[model samples]
Target: MAELRGTNPYHIKPPEPKVLPKNYTQGVDNLSSEDFLKIYIETLRYQDPFQPQDLSKMLEDMTRLNQIRYMNDMKSFMEGLKGWFNQITLLSSLSLIDKEFVFSTNKIDTLKGGQYYLLSSEDIKGATIRIMDGDDVIKEYQVDINKGLNPIELSDLPKGHYSVQILKNGMPVDSLNLGVMGKIKSVSVSGGELLFELENGELVSPSRLIYAGGM
Candidate 1:
């Protein structure tokens, strides 16, 4: 028999160590606090008994988790405060809509021999009032504001149907639809001069008129 020259089967090469891809632990940082806590507990349960986790490392991880939780709470509180302030500002602006004012006009109808007036309780200081008849520019005047009733004369205007406006510093101040009131309910022409019946039931000459309307 020929001597066996075959290589020894017991000389089998050890299996190559398994190689893992890089970035395998990249997603671990995205785990929620609860999930990370559960993973840590499981890792400790199965960790090799001889190589225990360090107490200092565990304390550091817990401290970092607490800091993250506090920061999240602070961010939530700031967001709520911002929402509350915006609501307050909106309510404050809405409060201005309820205020009323009284305004005056300077439009006079010269041919008709009468003047017009407007009455309102809304503030009209620093406003401009314009008077128009059909397509004609009768008169325009600025509102002179005072604490109480303000009087504006419109006797120099032309006679006809007239309209009045209330402005504040050249801008419309209030949207209240003001109505006109006569100095007296009825007027009687006397001495070649037109008279007016004011809403207060007082009879006065057109020249003595201040405002043309009432609120």
Candidate 2:
């Protein structure tokens, strides 16, 4: 170590860091197909006088660059398609307002009395219909099943949801749900998707609906 003449002699200078231009970007981060092609040309231009570049390796690199470029283009196209579909869906959902729809559910909205139907695939003479609220039996009624749409009317039930079970041969064979008629009240956006708000305090997706009647 060289001796210093100043009083403070233990200090050492840190090396200055290399600076890049403001527009300079790293090849590893922003490398594209054009940049890669330019690199290939430059490599060929500055090749060795004796030994030359391997043609196979250069072709492999070109192929990889082309594949990456194609994938990025496809990604952009798919993103555009998604945006168009969302726009169409938003426009269509707006027209669904104030329209009444019936979905397959166990919910039944009753005022004085409501009509419920049983769709039988075959003919049957006697089968019991049990209206249930969850595990508890609310009401037990009989339906004249005849392999068709059998309508059943019960006394004024509470304005809520109920499930109907079909009992044949003193045992429950099948179970179906009584649906409620609801009208769309308004629309709301949630997570970039549209939600249909019903008059009965329900939020559902327009895609989930299978049947819709007049406004």
Candidate 3:
């Protein structure tokens, strides 16, 4: 049996109690101005009769209260403005789900089927536009690829989803989704950002959009 070197039964110090802030106007339903006036009246009633109270300090307290209330009002106004702006933004995003979109993408969609524009980000000629399904190439088109909108006459192209692959010198340089002309599938908020989910299972930002009402 080992003997304890040091042992004290009642040597521990008691912890100090935490002090909370005093609510000066504790359950009163009156506003700040009313409460301040009530306190001022009570102070004057019981103040020292001989030693005059500082009227300047009381005026300063009232001024401070007004300033605090003004600031609170302005803060509420700014919050309302921000909420209105968010509502406008969300409404604009919702509109995209109905209108057709013409943006630079590889996934080409033809909802109405009249004409689909194929655009290139790079200036390269002799790039074969190969229509692809999965990894297999379905059809190829020989056209002088330019760095701007190149229209593909969609006379009878079936309304569906298709992918476009651009090849340079018989070698794959870039595979892009063909331009889409269809309504966005849905609009949702993810991670505090508005996302437009297209019919091709693509998520796009509404800010970078080009609207084409129809094919």
Clashes of each: 37, 0, 6
lDDT, each prediction: 0.51, 0.64, 0.62
Off by over 4 Å in 3: 1-82, 87-101, 104-106, 110-114, 153-160, 175-177, 182-205, 208-215
Once all C-alphas are superposed, what RMSD does model 1 give against the true structure? 31.5
Q: 1-215, model 3: which lDDT tens digit per residue?
A: 99766423234323333233576442232356777688778889988989868867876666677667657666776666555555456665665665677765556556534345665666777778766667866667777766656666444455576677778898876533356454588887665567787676768876646445433
What tens-digit string does per-residue lDDT give for candidate 1 at 39-130?
77887898788998774676567668866865766666665555444444433334323222222334443444422344445555566776
lDDT of 2 at 20: 45
Best model per lDDT: 2
Q: How close is candidate 3 to the true structure, as a TM-score?
A: 0.42
Segments of candidate 2 deviating more than 4 angstroms: 1-41, 45-55, 106-126, 133-135, 145-162, 169-177, 188-194
Angstrom error at residue 165, model 3: 0.2
Candidates 2 and 3 compared: the better one by lDDT is 2
- Residue pairs of candidate 3 with colliding backbone atoms: 105-177, 106-176, 106-177, 106-178, 107-177, 107-178
The model with the greater TM-score, 2 or 3, is: 2
**lDDT per residue (tens digit) for residues 3-59 in model 2:** 877322223322333344687543333466798778878988999959888867866
The lDDT of model 2 is: 0.64
Local error of candidate 3 at 156, Å?
A: 5.8
Question: Where is model 2 poorest over a 10-residue stretch in terms of lDDT?
Answer: 7-16
